[model samples]
Target: MQQTKRIAIIAHNNKKNDVLEWAKFNRFFLAQHELYATGTTGKLLEQEIGIPVHKLQSGPLGGDQQIGAKISMQEIDILIFFWDPLEPQPHDPDVKALLRIAVVWNIPIACNRASADFLITSPLMRVEYQPYLPDYQEYLNHNYDQQTTKVRQEQPVSLDTA
Candidate 1:
């Protein structure tokens, strides 16, 4: 990862203000990085914090999936998502999938203000860091080998009678 990170900030309806407050407090640190957010959150961050953000569709409208795609593509380096656990979300599955993609891609994720603070303040944030990526090719080859063996075993021998 580069010293200047690509950070995605997202917040559920009830947690928007809390995320905004956290963003305002960390404006100095956040300003140096590339910022991205889902619709309303992005607009609010721009209006309240004065930091420019790349806005995507709202979470319910596919923003979480967009962020997940970015993470999978390695375009996003970190995620700060303040999701409301108390309130049920209509798009809960997207939220879970986003978190899963972040982990699968080995990106930094901050689920709340406290964790975001720690993540932003960590010395690692200021340096070029290479995260460990698991080798999926090996896994694919293993699975292919198993499938090929199974297919061969499943095939019945046909004797040709002249």
Candidate 2:
């Protein structure tokens, strides 16, 4: 990863204001990086941070999966997701998947304001740091049941919500 990181930020409906406040407080460091966000959060961040943010769909509408895809593709270097743990989300699976993907890709993830603060202020953000990528070739090469493979091939997962 370069000094200018590709940062993906997300906030649950209940935590939107908290995240916005956090973003506003850390505007200086955040502006130096490439920012990405989901739906309303993106719009709010852009207004508050005064920087371009790559906006994806709303979380329940597939934004979480979009962020996961970006992480899998190495497009995102860090994730700042301010999710509400106390609340039950309609798209909880997608949130789990996004978090899983972030871990699978070995990127830094901050789930709360305190962690986000630590991440943004970390010295590593200002330098080029290459994370160790786990090789998944073997996993991909493993043979699956023909029936399952055929079923999966027949029904490809689409990320589009439209």
Judging by lDDT against the true structure, name the best candidate: 1
**lDDT (CA) for every model shown?**
0.94, 0.94
- RMSD (CA, Å), each prediction: 2.4, 8.6
Q: What lDDT would candidate 1 get against the real structure?
A: 0.94
Measured against the true structure, the TM-scores of the candidates, in listed sequence, are 0.89, 0.87
TM-score of 2: 0.87
lDDT of 1 by residue, 1-162 (tens): 998999999999999999999999988988999999999999999999898999999999999999999998899999999999999999999999999999988898999988999999899999999998767798899999999999999999888776
Candidate that would win on TM-score: 1
Candidate 2 lDDT by residue in tens digits, 1-162: 998999999999999999999998988888899999999999999998898999999989999999999999999999999999999999999999999999999999999999999998888989999999999877766645566778888996899999
State the TM-score for model 1. 0.89
